[model samples]
Target chain A: MTTMTSNALCFGDEFPASGAPCFVQVDGDGLTITVESEGDDGAGEAVPFSALTVSAGGLDHDHLVVKWTRVQGERTLYLKSPDVIRAFRETVPNHLSLPFAQAAEQVQQVRHRRRLVWSLVSGAILAMVLGLWFGSDLFVELAVSWIPVEWEQKLGESAYRDFLSHQEVMKEGPAVTALGEMTHRLTEQIPNNPYRFEVTVVKSDVVNAFALPGGYVVVFTGLMKKAESGEEVAGVLSHELNHVLQRHGLERIVKSLGLLTVAAIVLGNQQGLVGMMNQLGVELLTLKFGREQETEADLTGLQLLQRAKIDPSGMIRFFERLSEKDQGRMEWLSTHPMSTARAERLKAELAALPKKSPEPFTFEWKQVQTSLGSQPVAAP
Target chain B: MKSEILYPGAFPMVRVDLAAGEHIKAESGAMVACSPTIDIESKMEGGFLGALSRKFLTGEKFFFQTLRASRGPGEVLLAPTVPGEIVILELDGVNEYMVQKDGFLAGADGILIESKMQSLSRGLLGGEGFFILKISGKGMLALNSFGAIHKIELKPDQEYIVDNSHLVAWSSTTSYSIEKATSGWVASFTSGEGFVCRFRGPGLVYIQSRNPGSFGAWIRQFIPVSE
Candidate 1:
């Protein structure tokens, strides 16, 4: 009935004392167990193979544990020889012997799953750290992209407040009116602006004009005095307006403070934005936009002048006069430095300029200059 | 042999109708239900030593069941343990296919399953490299993947990139090389795509849409860990 049938030593409850263990034999019907007690009673019993099941124990030892489940309680036969289990397994093929692999598989699955989870968590954190390490510019851009328009306006207003606190804001006056009319002429052509147009003449001798966030364009008196014609003044104002239109102030803040810091400051605490104002330094006013930003502003400024029907040649003339006057040391030159390639690009663009019958100045330039002299100002 | 895919993609099962005297060799315990006419016999194939090596080395079952249609044409339903899609590839003894180790489901009698070793570097430092199971000879071989299987045909001089973990099976004619997903050190480490297998082919490569490794991580989040 089976292949490897032989006599072997086994343990059973029937034998009180052991002599030579037991002689277990396999037959067609069942296992024949021969046992001897101390009182000289030698008896044997037969168990059908179906009435028993194997305990598939750990693999460290050489033994086969047969657990009998058909009985009332449970009885076991531990055959000392390990090869008997293989012999027993091959006889009753289907669902007879436990391979121990099934239990091992379950243990492997759990251990592997935990290791897999930890590896993935560690990998994700490593990737995030490396992402921040290799490309912080990418993070800054991503953070900047997440900034809502409302937050941008709020940041702009804060920067404007910081700069304005250090200077005079010429509120309502004939000077403000003249400045407003000129800017309005240039701004009207811009479709859908996000800013409220307000021009302030700060009584400073910097000979420079700067645009604040949220459409606050501040021009210095020194620049107004230096202008040869109303077009020259319009040229400088138009350039400054381009800076405001492009939200350069906010971009600078985002670039300087780093995206993570800005994100924490702008998105987290309410006072975060204002608290970061100190790092902005005086660079907000003397802040020189990148060469790309300068070129973009110059080109955009030219378009604004065209829309207002003002001669764009005035922008070129202002640059030529300043570059000729000094190589360095001028405040405006320090911030908005002119390069030869920039001047060449402007000249080339001017050569292809369309013929426009530009309208004349509707406001008196001298009266606006005199109003600034008069100082008839009020709180805005 | 005639076969049909039942409820593919989500819960896939292959229903094969075998004519009289026809037989199918399937992974042990893969049978869900079968017709009464079909007789099942289990054996430790390739003898005792081979069976022991197959069990211990590859972590696959040593015993396989051969379900034969005895009296008349009968049906046998077979599926893998995991939820995935199953596909059958027919061979005429002229070609062979190398599949992922655990991808084997059920196949016709003539096909042989064997272990294939990768190159030393790939074998030692690869996702599924140590032992890749190969199915060859002349028969229909069924394969299972973690997700919907997608077939990509590559012409000469054309190469397709795939994540190594998602690879199911590919034509033996295709040449492949393993490389980091990107050349940059930081990007290679940080991009999360990791290593990729680039296959240059004049044949087909079957890929799974989802990677089982990533799916396991996603599933791990919802599982409760006991202290």
Candidate 2:
């Protein structure tokens, strides 16, 4: 072993954490600290000067935190005054100094490099967050396109089943059969229609009509009762059909829950609609289409009605009647724009389109109304 | 510069006394009181881009407030938004320390504040945030935490583990890894003990008794929702 040369001796032994009396013996020019353990055994260990890094505890420092190799617990020594700090500083040679101000110079150089590294990292993180946010919409849309039409139809069936459990349904009635025939006749006109549509007339007084994620067109008896003619009922159904065809509900689900959750549900047990709708029904039931989406549905539904030789004016007339009647429970219209704005906007939109000869559509409207078990409520 | 923790417990405040020409940098919105002789100047730290980076990555304010005793020794008071204790950590330049992103309140001059982004894998595996605030150089650094700060002195060949959200700061000498507190992911999640920080010593670590995340979540429930 190479003999270490230094000045200090028993530096750690003199200062006991419990303030116990200890003695030190100097052996050579090299300072080897022999720490006498405070235990009853009075054991001692030799510590070399190089194994220690001393901190002078500064001018106003309360205590000194001296790092000595192999020592456990607190090694802090209380500084009585500035003289004690200077005295402690004098113990270590200039080359072995650990003063605050002197060490600050070397740390500054390293800190400069660290600042540069952090700035770049921050910039990269910001860019990553923005990219993920913007790219997500396009990415999710593309993924949604790959989902099979069969899954959507199952989802709709599940939602319809959940709705029936939650409320009353008018299944297998003349009213439901008539509404089903009208929906099928209208749906036949759309070439390559992807959905197997089913219209259910729910036996409730709520003046609302909505389209589930799939092709389930849910029309309340109140909606049929409130309608003045068969064409008005057809107009509402056509609007709901557009919502299903455009996959707006699925788009919203992807946006809210993200691709991961959708993928999880898809990859999970495919036990029909209850598996999906049981978890997602609340959010989807109150799903509000944005202004842009509402406009798309309005314009697209108008074109579908026109192609089926049905007068698109029935769409505007039904909206105007709802506006004047001030019926607030229409979930279909509740999430859209203000009633007056929608009414005026739809009327203006119809005026811009080219005039097409619309057939005066006729059906057993009074018979369907009688089957609904209510007269049309007059606008007061 | 001389620093003292007034109250020294929950709701503790830092009172820093700056000598002539001495300066102190503090987190923005932390200053509650200051002597009239002290000049408070706010500027972008390390220049504009540096400040912007800190703002984005560390959630620090765009401007770092510097209090200087230009003429004579003056005092400034600093406090954090939450009710907590503050610790005055004195460094002699032998080591550097890492602090939780929101733990640092103020520091004596010559103390450089920088942020470090942890590896993505570590961040995903642990509860500690992606970025950690590093206080380096020679000076006093004040750290704030909910409730009182408990300092743990770790010995060599010993490993200490702390909940990630409860950990506030640790000495630079300690090597640490972000890890799961429990053996399995299912057990970790179900037990409500997720990720924790495992520190190997010999060094010091400061932790708070209460977690700010849980406290914030508790407070959030009582707040009224606005349309």
Candidate 3:
């Protein structure tokens, strides 16, 4: 029974440039639009509410548009006032208001579905990254187990010859004899060891040592000069020797070969094996072991020195000293990344082992240092 | 200006005869030939940003070629890039048309072409793309289709379902939503008719006889691929 009256614009069949201004009255069954012109009396056009199709219109969709058919053609009316639209919605029958309500519900559903899809996609990507991270490590271990030890020996021999070709190797000297004694003691302790355990002493000012794939260990004279005792030098040799025993260098190379190349090698592809061997010599010189591999070598090296009856404290003491003093200058520390946590872990491990008094080596440590000429060889 | 469709079925073209100083806007590169008196100039119809949006958003041409009979009255022939039929629509000021991308060929001076965005569901799944051409104002508008064009007039509240890819244009009075062609999602894709537009009308809907997507996929098998 309530009548809502508001100003509106009516675009007739002709759709004139500007719509004619009209006064709209909402009655029980329909809307009566009366055009306010000079000669037109109170007689207005009455359109049934059921006959109108309401939708949002205007350039910015700010106005409510209602369209319906008439005798001449289609007619459109624009309601721009918020009050009129609210009144119209409140007064219109339930069936007439259903479409607007349905449209609003559809928008809500779309936004909800879009948010769900985004979360699912991001979660899938995260799962894939985690899967690859853990899965690749297991895959590398499986592939490395398939490689023959003789092939590793050949790979290490080639890499060793290539490295010594570029450096001044101390072929015979008191430093070589001292290093030989340490290598002999370490290798004698290994049970069923397959490697020949060849150790080379290179004359250089950089304190560094590395082990190749098979049992080739390279020691720099600078490391010998830096050692306070023969036990310290033996400590470093045992750590490098563990790197060889664990096949850490080969593990690094196999990991870098990626999934496809490792699969090929595991499947007995001779071409892939030959291709990898050709690149191993160059890759060996620059390869840096992962932190896990370093920790493994550290713990296992302590056990090897324990079995050799050489003091295990020498190895931990050498690493702890290098980490604190001239950390940046020592190439060994740079490659090893000596953290305080590593030193702490090593100390805890040494404490757990049974007490044993280690015997000192026969050679004098100072004589070995003095035997290496002090010209200070440039770092290569 | 007066326009007529020549070669009505396949390989159809629009021949527009212009009066002095009268112009017709056609899709760029649509003109096959023009008389000596007719001067051709390519212009971005609704300024730089408008044309840029139309190009990237709706996949329409960046520029529209305006053929003006500057010197005197002249005739010009225009054709679409593909071989298809051309339909001419007479637009009254009252009703507007929503056209699929690349459906427009040429229009008289009074017709205004602008890009319009549809609702989210229609834009994402409709296959007609997100942005479509909104043709309004009063003039003759020529539309080209990949195949024969069919016109259907529906009474008020009448419902008709159209395959999304085959749709050409429809009157603004009609409301449509995108849905799967069949009731089931798996069946819709297996039936080779995926998404469809369901329109309720008191207006006209234009559809083409062939689907361009299927035709391209058909031809792709015959082409040799190199490794």
Among the numbered candidates, top lDDT falls to: 3
Cα lDDT of model 1 by residue, B1-227, tens digit: 99889987868899999999899999899999999999999877667876677677666788888999998889999989888889888764424466777778888999887766454445544567556776766678898888889888754336889878888887654557778889986797699877888886434688887788899999999999989
Measured over all alpha carbons after superposition, the RMSD of each candidate to the real structure, in angstroms, is 23.8, 15.5, 9.0
Quick one: ranking by TM-score, best first? 3, 2, 1
Write candidate 3's Cα lDDT for A77-133 as tens digits: 766666667777778887778876654355456556756765686689998898778
lDDT ranking, high to low: 3, 1, 2
Q: Highest DockQ among the candidates is held by which one?
A: 3
Going through the candidates in order, the fraction of native interface contacts each one reproduces equals 0.00, 0.00, 0.00
Per-residue C-alpha lDDT of model 2 across residues A287-359, encoded as one tens digit per residue: 7876767778888888788777777888778877776656757654576544677767777877877778876
Q: How accurate is candidate 2 locally (lDDT)?
A: 0.69
Score chain A of model 2 by TM-score against the reference chain A: 0.62
TM-score of 1: 0.42
Best by TM-score: 3
Which residue window of length 10 is worst by lDDT in model 2 chain A? A1-10
Interface RMSD of each: 26.8, 11.2, 8.3
